[model samples]
Target: MRVLITGGTGFIGAEVVRQLVAEGGHDITVFHVSGSQRRLADVADRVTLIRGDVGNISHVLDAVKTARPQAIFHLGAILSTASDLDPSAAMHANVNGTFNVLEAARILDVPQVLFASSIGTYGLGMTGPHIDDLTVQRPLSFYGTAKLFGEGAGNFYRHRYGLDFRGIRFPGICGPGVRTPGAAQFHSWVVEECAKGRPYTIEVAPHTRVPIVYVRDAAAGVLALARAPRERLVQFNYLINGVPPTPSAEQLADAVRARVPGARIDFRVDPQRQAFIDRLMKPVDDRFAREEWGWNPAYDTDAMLDDFLAELAAHPQRYPD
Candidate 1:
């Protein structure tokens, strides 16, 4: 099957592209904006690279028409910080861009459309052990609001136009490569800081816990859902949560100390940053996705940390002091 992935050069998108390419027998074309090409240097030859913004409906439609992709993975969107700073841009990227992708899929008659939603949609005042699909979404930020809108839009298209849409509410995704400038950057920053043996500031408080997913597992989950049977997915806009492991600063520091003995980490609570993330930290339940698509995590906190340390060990230059 031929596939088209928007924002295919990003950290998470690149991981998805890597997995799709490795799966073989499927042709992949990545659509990215200017200056994003360098990020795809590793996979440029493996997949076709198209430069354009998803906000432009014509561009997206043209890409789909040109690629003739049976499946479309729309991962292009603005981050929390940028979204908060410039809400109009966020709206254009997250809201308008999503519409463009869905419209393109509708026009091209794409079989499956996978949209990347976030846990942020489940905003503040969520205090519980398990936040399942039934939980109401109370988005707090413009970014979250836009994501919620995207999900709703996709559902509308599915019901009215017979478009197959799947939504994945990703957690704090951690991995090597692009530096994701969002509320979840700390997930990867902690490892990068540890790799460099340098002291870094913690954005959120020590007790603040959020769901996290290894990049590889996140990529796999997207693919699985995209290919799942439509009958199995009764919910068009499904909220699939990745595994969330509570790794406070102390726990993360311990992990770092174990990997790089005497690693320095100064925990200075940033109230503003903490508030934004705290609003989105809720226990996630994924029984629906597990039963419907056999979605399971491949790595736990310990295994993830070990793998991160191993990757850093292999290339020390990337994380400089």
Candidate 2:
């Protein structure tokens, strides 16, 4: 399979590229903006890398034309914190970038396009303990709004153009070397800091809970969805949960302490950040993803932590202090 991945040098995107290289049949092209390719250095020899921004239609068109990919995994976008900081930049990157990818795929006759959506698509005023695939999406942040728009646009492309457009609404993706600044990022940093024998603080309250997926599971789940039989999919986009039973801040900290003896983990609540989490901490129901496409995560919390630490230890250069 010939595949092109936007944002293929990012955290999850890098993992996807690595996995594809390991799987051994596909020819992969990574489309990314100018920046460090450190995340992909290990697999750099195996895949083709292209420098470009998804927000630019010309760049998108050229990438698709050159790669002639059968599949395009559209993972490029402005994340929450950055989006909130500059809404205009977010609009150009997140919203326009998605449109550019979809249009390019349609024009170039790409058979399948997989989108990366987010839990932020569901916001305050949601009236359920767990938000499912069918829940109304009224995203509070510009980032979430853009993701929701991607879902809608993908559905439109699927129905109107006979494109195999699929998307996954992922929860907080946790793993090693998460440098992105966001309220939920602590889920990753707590473990990473502890693994480095450095003191880490949980900004949110101890009891605050949120769903998270290990980065590897996230990459696998999206790829699995992309490869599933099209007829089996009742919906174009699906919500997916990672791990089981969402963990509180304290529970996660305790888990880390258990693994790394004498790990220093403390909580000093940031009311503003806690409020941000409180509004969007509901568990997600991904039954549709499981039943329709056989989505199953390989790691539980403990296993995820173990592998995360091992990766940081083994590849200390990949994630530097």
Candidate 3:
């Protein structure tokens, strides 16, 4: 199976690439923007690297034509903070970029396109105890708006052109290389910073809880969705809570301290930042994901923390603070 992954060099994308290569037999192509294989250091030699911006239709089309992929994993996007900082750029990258990928798949007769959607799609403000597949998609940010639009567009392309479009609405994906600026940064940063013996502060309150998933689980969810029998996939996109029991900022801090013992962590809740963080961090129900495609996340919050710190510990040089 020849595969092409857009934004394959990103944090989650890198894990996706690693998982794909580990499976073996599939020829992989990474279409990235930075042209830097820094995140893909492990599997760089195994996969073909192609430089392209998703916003550039021509570049995407060329990459698609070359890869002629049986499955296209579209993971490229402008994230939350970046989207707020520059919505025009976000629109170009997120909205227009998705369009380009779908269009390329359609024109090139690519059979399947697995999109990376987000929890941002839900318009439901204030994530409460329960959320299911039927939640309304009224996005508050440009990033969420673009993702929701992409989901609809994928649905359209699926029904209209028979493209095997599948997607998962991800929670805060926590792992190494967590550089995207946002309140959510604390989720990954707290663990990495603690593991590196560096002091870090959270702007949100200690009790602010957000849904999260380990990077590996997130990647696996995508792969599982893609590999599921099409006949079993009555869902266009499903919400995937990668880890159970969304930990609060306080819980996260405690976990790090327990693991590292000498880890430094503090909190200074910022109301402004907390506004959107609250929405994005809201709890998510993934029963649909689990039932529809066996989307079982191996890591719960505690397990996720253990592995996250362990990974950082294994590679101290990679996480120097």
Clashing pairs in 2: none
In angstroms, the error of model 3 at 114 is 0.4
- What's the residue-level lDDT of 301 in candidate 3? 79
* All candidates: CA RMSD (Å): 2.2, 0.9, 1.7
TM-score of 2: 0.98
Ranking of predictions according to lDDT: 2, 3, 1
Error of 1 at 239 (Å): 3.4
Report lDDT (Cα) of residue 41, candidate 3.
Answer: 78
Q: TM-score for candidate 1, please give it.
A: 0.93
Instruction: List, residue by residue over 1-321, the lDDT tens digit for candidate 1.
Output: 899999888866777888877778879999887575554565679999898988889889989988999999998788777898999989888999999999988887997789999877777656676677778888888888999998999999998999889998887787765364777677678777767766777767777776778877888888888988888886655565545566766677677677777777767878877876665666678878888888888877788778877867775544333
Model 2, 68: alpha-carbon shift in Å? 0.6
- Backbone atom clashes (below 3 Å) for every candidate: 0, 0, 1
In candidate 1, the residue pairs with backbone N, CA or C atoms under 3 Å apart (3 or more residues apart, or in different chains) clash, namely none
Q: Could you tell me every candidate's TM-score relative to the true structure?
A: 0.93, 0.98, 0.95
lDDT of each: 0.79, 0.91, 0.85
Q: Ranking under TM-score, best-scoring first?
A: 2, 3, 1
